[model samples]
Target: MDAPLPPPLFPALAAPTDRPALRCGPDVLSYAELARAAGALAAGIAGSGRVAVWAAPTARTAVAVVAALLAGVPAVPLNPRSGERELAHILGDSAPELVLAGPADELPAALAALPRVDVELDGEGSGAVPPPAEADPESTALIVYTSGTTGPPKGVLLSRRAVAASLDALAEAWAWTADDVLVHGLPLFHVHGLVLGVLGPLRRGGEVRHLGGFSAEGVARELASGGTMLFGVPTMYHRLADALPGDPALVKALSGARLLVSGSAALPVRDHERIAAATGRTVVERYGMSETLMNTSVRPGGPPRPGTVGTPLPGVEVRLVEEDGSVLDGSDGETVGEVQVRGPNLFSGYLNRPDATEAAFDGGAAGGWFRTGDMAVREADGTIRLVGRKATDLIKSGGYKIGAGEIENALLDHPGVREAAVTGEPDPDLGERIVAWVVPSDPADPPADAALADHVARLLAPHKRPRVVRLLPSLPRNDLGKVLKKRLPRG
Candidate 1:
């Protein structure tokens, strides 16, 4: 029609310009309109700019994100209601040349000087025009920042090639079809929401239902609202299960789902079974991180194993390697050493942090290999079982190793505990023992420490059972919804 622009610069996504692209509230924008809105916004901003969209999960924010991608600018999504300190820090880090906000909300005085773009195409002032560059596989496409171990936030750079390859692998491996309708209710900032939930579906012209804020009730309602798939974190699944009556509807929708997926954090094997019991479907727990969108997933249509994050997807090349970069000989399961993966889906580098990049590549080179900090033992059946995270999440007691996740999973299966996070605290003899912080689903019936200890005693060996268990309001979780064990209060 009008010069046929580069097929919208992505293959997995079909520019469904004729079909309704974003269905939000009472408004629906056709794919053509959505593209135009994004293209206009893209054209309005300078290349080396930052665009902070509404932090809340929404179809509108989804549009802004895609438009930013096509326009060749980086969009830093932030919570619209972020605290002053958080907003301040992110603004400083991203250093956007402009800001994007909807009508009616006044621009923050801090960003008053920055040109504001109205989603309705009101701000027409041209800053520097962004040069047209083909979406390079290795070039940085997005910079997602996380509160670093200790310093300013660190941004994980994902290039177009990386995301594209990820989509191809997921679509093929999970057998996602363009016709699938996924009800995704996770926060969009993390890799799971962005890579798997949003981009994965959109790239293939699948339908997505968005919740501005996640509510288990809202998610369940939406799932009943013509959804064919459910993709969310284990926490989300838990909330959904709790909100529902008996997990029947949860299971019904989940069982009826073309696929039910969980990632970003471990899906406790027990929760997987609990969700399946309630919903009548297996919640396929997958594995990946910010560095790699999705390398392995528990089978969707097949077994949906309780503890294993299934084999590597078709395009992904996985190997077990020693710390010194030597490949291991352990495919008895599927070669479980430190998981070193090379594929188009893996990220190029961490943004502007050469030292971090160098350290990341210590186990391998820079093609597509990511030395995942996860210590997993691949089984002979091609399934991988995660032992724990190297950076954190592993607890040592009495010279043996126990994954905090394993202990937490056992606690959650007790039916009394709602949430659990295990960490290593000082112990005289065992060096370090497992300390679990638990949140009770039923406050009145919260199990006592002795009761929980006994329950865990049945599930784990005497040594692996939690040495100490404490009830809490919630576990410390980071922005990405990962438990911050270091932040857990010492008992």
Candidate 2:
């Protein structure tokens, strides 16, 4: 009998008869019910390695994913609402022969149009127990794709060991209970939502209330119903803050959460302060990338320093190095270098493209360290504040290199600016110059170019400043809150 090592992800689901695992609107699935559904789907999938899941948000997608895992097939859950071209690309890239998908009442036709393999599992099954043959810890468990700023996209391959280790590490460090209800809606494509949103909560036996669409009203309703935790991006937080700025009832509903987490991209220090005051629940700012899962996080009620990603996580080792891949001098707190990490959770490699994979390890020679392209400067207290990505997000102006992220942080601090993107524009004098496309909080009251320039001068070094400022109602972005600065036309 082949025995799969007990998956670290299903301590809660391990005993399906013990509790209710998922609640999607009026539908509530117990551990037992979900286990049964997953088993049927798993049996149907058998072993195709990867299966495309085009289902809308339901107990169904969750069921299919778990089932696929049980049957030794890796589940590739695509965003069902994408265009035909996008879906076709996914199908072509993944090369999945099977797809289990359906559109429920809450899910519309748009979500159902993506390629899905239909399977008939009437929800009458119960191989909830992991396969007797434990899955290989080193086997490819997940393949998450990130839309590259410069190119099409790259598939980040994560192994089962990495996924299991990451989840186990999180559960051991963060205290959670079966009775806690976590409100989550971030898409399943990205690791932030998939690993943390689904894998982490389920690992701890916590009840998850996964929503398809996010709105203050909808979130408030769920929180009011006793959701103990909420995870969202900075944009989502801003919208929630806007919808109910300083309402006590709204705050209470938000505060009812045991934890409020903000991640995916850098959270503006200004927005963090405002939302913290409004809700009275300190938001735990976390740092993560598609390549490496979460690396650092700011604890609630700590000093809550501005612009710093505080401390390395458990079982995680971090080091700072120069552009030439040399370690930074400990004496210089201002020494900015690339962030490097070696951990159990580090990615194996890009799905294909050996050259790119080799290039990713530029800084990691000694240990199994994965080179994170983002540049960072270390503080005396050991918090690593990210400057920007050296790969595509850096801007050069007047013979000096500038991190667009640094300028964007300064722009978000302004009362009138809601969002901003900084990019390089062709300049004959300097190699390239800084240009910022800004989204004003109030479109009717746009800031003048001079006023914006003055604002930039206050925080950034002269060379780091954006010489060209354009006023726009909103900056273009991807499915995630990442600013698509490259897409904004330069004047």
Candidate 3:
């Protein structure tokens, strides 16, 4: 028989004192305190099947998740901002035994029907409970829901082995250590802020400070005061770029940081250059999704290119395949193909939806490759540059397969343009006509559609220019700052 695996995801729990394990706003807990608190919560819910977490962006949410993991129960992180219908669907689909939340957090109408457990920082514990009984590596750990662009949101099953493998791989790739103090204000529902932001620090036995909310002043203060790393999406970085010229404190904070990373969506090259110019620090970008925790990242010691997502992490095999399913022989850095990945980091399958699960894997479970549905160009050096989603971002027009991302980037380069989103609408002659939705840098001096279209043609191929351009006050965006292209008005 195989030896039992240790229950705690964090191995260094036994040897810690005085160092903050997690700090959100003013709530702080040391490693010893965390162990005590989590142990108590774990003991209380040791035998629950699957659990739902009211994932508020707070230390309490972190504690509840850790406690669930310690008890070896799969956790479902519920997004706080979800609409009533979306919330109802997720709760019904996952069918968790109970929901966990902080003592003071108010439950939404969607979660009120379920049994509730409140977590307390100063909760009593009999002391550290015995390690949970050894479970199979394939046991489900988290059931994260997708954005449901195609259909209803489906829960992606993530296993213990997958989480451990991904976090460890990222630790090695990022040179993450206990000495590093991570800081971010991302919401707790997504993988970026939850798994990478919260769990990443816990695994390394380091500290994490969540701002409770994001602001340039808040981030600057945290980074200026012992925070070594900052994680954010492009929107947050754009705010940083906008604030750099006036805020000397912000400039000093960014310049002194050990690492700056952008994810959840691609960071525009213009914002990258702006931040770099102000602070002389290159912000690294990584590629990941809820289905796959993290596939690639710019290694800590590697060069931080403006737009590339570096190479695959340790144990992850990433490759590009043509539409016909044949793998590219060698990347020319121009051939666009679908991104396929196979690694321990991959999710088990979608929860209870065997048909959908079966369709995600290429050959079978034995084949081990999962089609990501994202299209990208792979450089010869293995760096992956995402073009966009296969369903929406790839525009087939005039016998040319152009990625909307490139044209969007070109449009953003215009001095008068502040934000840009590109989409393809049906056209009889071109198959799909490129449409650009833009926000002007200055509303009074907005660039004409012809001028902006000409700008893109000059920067890239003429065919890539927008056939129609519409000016909006702002692009529709999600909590993670991803541009919601589907929500754009089709006129």
Top lDDT model? 3
- Top model number, TM-score: 3
Evaluated at residue 328, the lDDT of candidate 3 is 79
The runs of at least 3 residues in candidate 1 whose Cα sits more than 4 Å from the true structure, single-residue gaps closed, are: 1-15, 46-50, 81-83, 105-110, 121-133, 246-251, 320-328, 331-337, 363-365, 441-451
Ranking 2 against 3 by lDDT, winner: 3
TM-score of 2: 0.90
Q: What TM-score would you give candidate 1 relative to the actual structure? A: 0.87
Worst 10 residues of 3 by lDDT: 125-134
Error of 3 at 356 (Å): 0.8
Whole-model Cα lDDT of every candidate shown, in order: 0.69, 0.72, 0.88
Model 1 lDDT tens row, 55-156: 456565676677678676767766555566766777777777776666655656666766776665322343322235544445666777665555666667
Model 2 Cα lDDT, one tens digit per residue, 174-270: 4556667888777776787777887677767877888866777768878898888888888888787776665666777987777777888777877
Tell me the lDDT of candidate 1: 0.69
What does candidate 3's lDDT look like per residue over 232-304, in tens digits?
9999999999999999999999999999999988888899999989998999999999888999998765666
Is 1 or 3 the stronger prediction by lDDT? 3
Count clashes in each candidate, considering only residues at least 3 apart in sequence or on different chains: 14, 12, 0
